[model samples]
Target: MNKINIVLADDELLFLQGLKAILGNEEHINILFDAKDGDHLIQQLRDAKTLPEIVVTDLKMPGLNGVEVTKIIHKEFPNIKVIALTSYFSKPFILNMISIGAVAYLAKNSTPALMIKTIEEVSKKGFHYDEQVMKYVHESITNPKDKKTKSTFDANYFTKREIEVLELICKQHTTADIGEKLFISPRTVEGHRNNLLLKTEAKNVAGLVIYALKNKMVSIENDSL
Candidate 1:
């Protein structure tokens, strides 16, 4: 199989080196290069012949932040994907990244295994937002403060598997958890999620929850979450 090409950006040189070492050991992920901040990353992108499939960036950087980088890449190089690996976990920051074009969000504490898996998933599926990000999206949209615009949901509109997947997602189940619960593989869960996103007309997993709650497919308490 062809390797997944990637560029990594972070402000701390030591952290970047550590991350580079960790990701470098993964045989499938090729570290095309590293940059200290978004501006440098953008310059690298412009200079490189073959654009990487993804960029792992820290939200806090010296020249430009991850959000700015993600926005620039989204607007200029639509084919390139971004995964934010940062300490900032605020609801607004996470939501802003997703809205602007980040395909994934990983807390700085995310395990290396999860980081690797997220990179692969986003590279293949075009997006991979973890449960934490999804939770914020869910709460923001479902919060009583936001005017809930009701939409008519027809159960008949979805297939049995699709509805099952949607329910698991609304419950904030991780891709692995949903796969285990449904006796499906993670790849299968990804497929179902992609379909749900399209069928529900939702932007991301959080949007799926909004769709579910707005249409009364899920309750506020969200016992599963």
Candidate 2:
């Protein structure tokens, strides 16, 4: 079995050590390193011989901060996924992180089991949001105060196959699952997904889902997991 390589960043020593110890026990998880602050985290990423597949970072840090680090990772190391682990579980915080390219968001108080599940799901599916986060996402789209400039879907924007793939993705279907349901190869599903990302100007799968929701391409009732 292939291990999931990850790096962790947190300012609190006890919390950071505890998190490391918990994740370190999982046979499928390999901790590449741990950093005490956002600056250190970026430096570690820059100096590493092998980059981690995922980075789990705390939002409140001394320098750069989790949001800043996430933005940097999204821009500089696009392949490396980010999971925001912070005490702030407000809807705005969660929505902000998702929009900025975090593939998962977790409260610092999240259970070890949930944390493990999130890591595995994100490793396989590219993003993982709990029901609560999903609710926030839906509400963010519907709430008039939180609304952004509306995007209109052009009839020529995406092929029918791409729309099907996007709908499946918003419904939380994996690439293999989508391929099986759509009668296409997993690689083809991936190609469609890549095109969707490019056309929507989305940073990741999470961004794509948000774009679909914002554009009314998919409804929460239909896409809810």
Candidate 3:
């Protein structure tokens, strides 16, 4: 199997090295390099012949903070998946990262197994929302300020089946699960999903969910999702 290469960044020497050592032992995780700060990471990216699959960065750093780094990669190198390394986060801070295109945030004290699992999930699924992140996302639905009060959605554009498919997608149901619940073939489910992507103009599954949320199409407050 081709290993997942990661460029991990943090200003703290001990923590950075310790994390590198822990993740280094994993069979499929390769530490491409560890940067002391985001600026250094930028330089490393420029120097490297090949880009890594993931860039795990501290939330706060000396030269450039996680937000700035995330924006840079999201704009310049959209293919790379980013995971924010943080000891703590508020609703707005974490939400901003997600908006800026970072896949997830991992607590600094997280176990090595969870780190590996998150990296794998992000690499495969294009995003990973841990329980903490999911809880916050669910809560955001009920807050008036968090809701997109003005929607640009054209309800007439989507059929009832497409809307049901969208709600299932927002609920994080797999295609197979969705098909089983909806009593449709998996191939048919994919066709509907592609139509959702086309109509919503979303880039990926995560983008689709974000679009749905922004359009007030899916709400965790009402549905079990």
Model 2 lDDT on a 0 to 1 scale: 0.87
Cα deviation in Å at residue 90, candidate 1?
1.9
TM-scores, all models, native as reference: 0.62, 0.64, 0.63
Q: In model 1, what lDDT does residue 98 have?
A: 75
Candidate 2 displacement at residue 122 in angstroms? 0.5
The predicted structure with the larger lDDT, 1 or 3, is 3
What's the candidate order when arranged by decreasing lDDT? Answer: 2, 3, 1
User: Model 2, which residues run further than 4 Å from truth?
Assistant: 144-225
Model 3 residue 1 lDDT?
61
Candidate 1 global TM-score: 0.62
Give the runs in model 3 whose Cα sits over 4 Å from its true position: 141-144, 147-225
Clashes of each: 0, 0, 0
Whole-model Cα lDDT of every candidate shown, in order:
0.81, 0.87, 0.82
Question: Candidate 3, after superposition: displacement of residue 39 in Å?
Answer: 0.7
Highest lDDT model number: 2
Tell me the lDDT of model 2 at 125. Answer: 95
User: What TM-score should be assigned to candidate 2?
Assistant: 0.64
